[model samples]
Target: MDIDFLKSQLEDHDQSQLLWYWESLDKDSQEKLYNELKHLEFSNINGYFKQAMEDLKHASDKIDNLLQPLPTEVCGSVTGSSPEELKEYNRIGLEEVGNNRVAVLLLAGGQGTRLGVPYPKGMYNVGLPSKKTLYQLQAERLLKLERLAKQQTGKHCTIPWYIMTSEHTKQATDDYFKQHNYFGLEKENIILFEQGLLPCIGFDGKIILANKDKVALAPDGNGGLYRALRKWNILEDMEKRGVTNIHVYCVDNILVKMADPVFIGFCRTKKAECGAKAVEKTVPTEAVGVVCKVEGHYQVVEYSEITVETAELRRDNGQLTFNAGNICNHYFTLDFLKHVSQVEQENQLKHHVAKKKIPFVGDDQQIVKPTEPNGIKMEKFVFDVFHFAKNFAVWEVLREDEFAPLKNADTAAKDTPTTCREALLSLHHRYMLDAGSKFIHSDGSSLSDIPCAKKAKESGDCQKSENDDQFNKCEVSPLVSYAGEGLEDLLSGKKLVPPVQIVMGPSDITPSIIQNVTANGTTN
Candidate 1:
């Protein structure tokens, strides 16, 4: 827009102060700024600017309130555990899957910046034996689940997979999936959508320009899922597809069970509109959010918000009172999401401010990267809607089998690609052992030659030996078994070589087992 129009619009919204730097810009810069403003719809931009100003003014008070310890209660009442309970949950979940009442939503908006990669996090390979990207692994899991549901129900069904991408990672993610042929899933069953983004604001409550032509912006956070759902009409789409429950998860988790039936079944059986899968915190001081009830409403309390005393509190059974660690895996009924997305209840979710050193153009129109935090980015978390759920459920899961996240670069000690890879391999090794398969190193030595064997021998722990494999690696395909169950018949009496990948059918088994046999062949 021209200067006169811009001035009138700003004046009409009482935001004339934004024009302070307008005259200082060169012709090119002026055009760029004007185009950006126009694209952002200058008429509605003042409200956001006003909100940002107010947010900046109250940010300090908000931080103080967020720091205060929340009153937490034991989560056991809403938590489910035990194999028998899992079986029941599985039954219910499978029924839903058979009835085509389930879908999977993957939160893949974030880039692999922490991992020191410029690509999307979903495209990063954690050095798996099959060299599968996160997206590919998740897709394969969904395909396997679909097959399982069909087998049990004796009817073909499709579980739609929805992936949320951010502006920064959307194109790269789309191209990656296209290059991989949607990882063997039917193309029509996969849906990819971009999440919303909000402009970054400086500490002084002014918008920061990333360069001469662009404004600094970031994803609106996972809580934007609600808004995105409504914006994309996904709820209506789900209804048309007969989807009742959504398995929501983050892309960083390498061991996530996609569209897990047990989780869905458990929530349905309990008549819960929302459910979360939580793993017992490894220690009282672990830097993970704890799922607990605060003021009789379900919410996750970050470790920073809890006192040392409360963090260490234990129950009579010797488990930590607030042991349920929120792992970002949740099951939400379509109706619950619809309720949360309604216009009247939209404001129930709150925004969180994150301080960061956002790169921006200086007064000289040159880009400057600060060494310290220079701006604030406001975000909304997906879990903030927990309080709106009238009925909520929490399920306890084993961390080792279900929760390995790839979050950092190799320099970090935990949650790095190396650690995630090791966790995947170790879990596969355990599955092989459970199926009565033996392992041997390249030199024909038993796996006991590794360091884990010495510790297992000292402690006389058979279970430890089963998973110890410092000198070996194994990877299991979800197509073979979802949770390492029912593999005995396929693997019994076989000697699995190190660094093997096991998939469905004998034809796909890798590392060349000691004996290759068909249904008609007998083992030596």
Candidate 2:
């Protein structure tokens, strides 16, 4: 913590005004400020400050035009219309997984602020019957995928799990994983790294100070994944580990398929440098980004950027023409990441501006929590690099089965804890029905076909029929079956009580036998 060096750097960047409130700090506050500055590498502070200034200056001009409908081509033939093509993709994906050429990158740098929690979003429990955290659920899926690859290829392979945390979430997330023993996966195979953070800039293009000794800083955004990979030397590690393709996804997506082989295979088989997993938008006005081409380059256009007429435009098949909603799940070849990491190629990515109500030290040196937005946080999106891809692919998936995100608290109807819980329960209930399991109520009657005389005649209770009971309270663990694939055989001739959790227990059952056994709670 060289005071002279710090002052000189600030002077050089015309940012010496940052020290106006410095002299007012007490001895302890000065020491804290010194440490914070030192840890943030104040020697190189010029670059960050300058970038923030430039971002603030150009923020207004960066709002993309939504006048024209983006030109988007279907990535591949629809799976429903062409099953063989999808089969080929699945086969290719399995082959890649078996060959040990894949890795999973999870973007978990976000805090659960929107969810009204102070911990990492991955640590929030959505009140499932198993009470599993998002991290546990995702980790277990990777383990199951590993087993599936081994079974299909007759070779053992470990898919390395890479998680990108943030300064805000790194320690808490680390402690959580340690407590859960890395969710039953090999601890060494799971790598956790922090994403970069940037200082918040006031509307006037000056950095905001949360306190006399501390500058207000925030995570740089998911797009910072590229910078993080380069900064942390993760790209080099991936290369050494023989990871050819990376499947990157957001941590909030409870249904994300880690290192999804089919997606990796699709990209590899098509010789695409980048691929995005998209789902057809549920409606024309869905508030999700649409993966489309702009002036002949691939990119994601936010819902707010499109005109209502353009959004409502439909194709001959009665589907929204620009319906491929980007789900923040992507595949990138190792070579693509390496290329993007280079200085010359890195500039292809662009930054977006987010306006937020940043609490900061006011002129009176008091922390003020403003009611309205007071500053802008600049961010680069991972998808911003899509235009740099030599060959880009988009794979459409079923949204209901693969895209329930836990984002909001109890307030919102969708993307909230309630919805996420219901989605999981619904999925598990579907799995049970597919597995030939009958739901029975407490009255010893078939839930699905309760006699009118036996059915509860109460107003609200009568409305809650077999269909409602199916998903009332159900949870299926990934250790039991990933994506409900092998449950039919495991639960065959077995009755499962509703409001039960199916988990893989600590018994020496063979993989073949264990694949179908619901160990935790099942009826005869």
Candidate 3:
């Protein structure tokens, strides 16, 4: 932390960037750094460096210890509530929008190399017509949710969007949002924090120093959310901001409900420290973690751990013993977070090991080669905190509209751009049908007597002659539907029909150009 000592260390690594960082520090920040170094003054510089390394290793190790399998299930049995018993939940969920609160925490630190893009995953445009990048779409969701919360609660329930970035993504992520004016979000409310990194290890688990002064480190994985929250002092910040709960989800999920109020209200009503939104497994083979009581506590068991017995567990009525699945969408209470942070015995969270390819510089520091899965990187799962909770709950939701993970390149089987596009299109498809739009038949024949199509049905009224084979069989879905629609289609719909370009909230869909759409078409 000492300026001179830091300079010497930077020189040892021959990393010019650290010098730039030091020079960029303001007076107050520099003074704070000097104070932090005061305790090290008695030790030799090398000893001080070694001590720092030890502290980091200890913290990382503690996290690793907490991940060990639990001895008992802390979560109670899943409620098999009948429709009548679930009335209150349905009522509260539908009755008010703003009455419940919402917050968005995006884990978006990695690049889009898997997706074959040059930018961050958030910056990758999913081939939509509006050309909205992942970040833009997500930011828009946050803005709309903020408005809905305000309208429903009659109070300004600010939707503070927290983005956790890594060394690889912080600058690019910030610059993209900055160029777009944070997409109309209040700049102060959009918090960005850097995730902690663990030193990269070789195949033997020995730390690989990037240079004489620093060890190469990688983002501790998504499970590192808690530590990132702690290092950034986010819990205190949330409490100070009067944010009672936080809805945490990842950035790659295009269909995630940003800070969904229903989930928040449910957690609040149940007095639960954690709330997880889940989807029933389509089948036993589906690749999703199951939310179930482990030993005796509520936890998400990885699909890999589910043996035939566990996966086949069923009650007398033939219902799945573990029906709820972990979608990674969660809600957590602020008070619980404080308690966990304060309790040292409960402080260490267990870590999951993930193997990844890491880049390493050679002895000359000239040529760098990316290594193969050399070793496992330790990280704590956010759900591992479930054990610390006194109460827990899971809310079931539709998977098609809520879960789609983008983790591969265009070449990968499931995560390709084709699949992402289809997923978005599928959401749009459902939204349109719900809006009373029918799909065009292959025969170009009408499935229903839609007013717009009816008016254009006359012979030669549109393009092809009515008598022509193409004319009688051609059918097309409505142009304007939902978020990921092509802008060209929306424009065409507007010019040819009444209203197009529908925008959607968490629970409802309306025309993006609402006033115009309503004026031209009949409003119920």
By TM-score, who's the top model here? Answer: 2
Deviation (Å) of 17 in candidate 2: 2.9
Tens digits of per-residue lDDT for model 3, 343-425: 36234665555555655545554435565665445555667777676687777776676777788987678866656655665
Better of 2 and 3 by TM-score: 2
Model 3: residue 420 alpha-carbon error in angstroms: 2.3
Q: How far out, in Å, is residue 31 in model 2?
A: 4.7
User: How would you encode candidate 1's per-residue C-alpha lDDT over 1-524 as one tens digit per residue?
Assistant: 57798778767755454455677778888888777665554443345555655765665441212322223321222244667877777888988998899999989899899999999999898876567778877887887788788878888988999988888888998788789777778888888888888777677656677876577888989988888888888889899999989999999999999988877877787788988888988598999998777776778887866777778888788888778889999989999989998866766666767789999888776889999998878778888888887788887778888999999999998999998988787787788888988776445556653336556667886445333443346677776777787678878877654556675532354323423222243422
Q: What is the C-alpha lDDT of each candidate?
A: 0.76, 0.76, 0.58
Work out the TM-score per prediction.
0.86, 0.88, 0.69
Off by over 4 Å in 2: 26-32, 35-74, 77-84, 449-471, 493-495, 506-524
Number of clashes recorded per candidate? 0, 3, 15
Model 2 scores a C-alpha lDDT of 0.76
Native-to-model Cα distance after best TM-score fit, residue 458 in candidate 1, in Å: 15
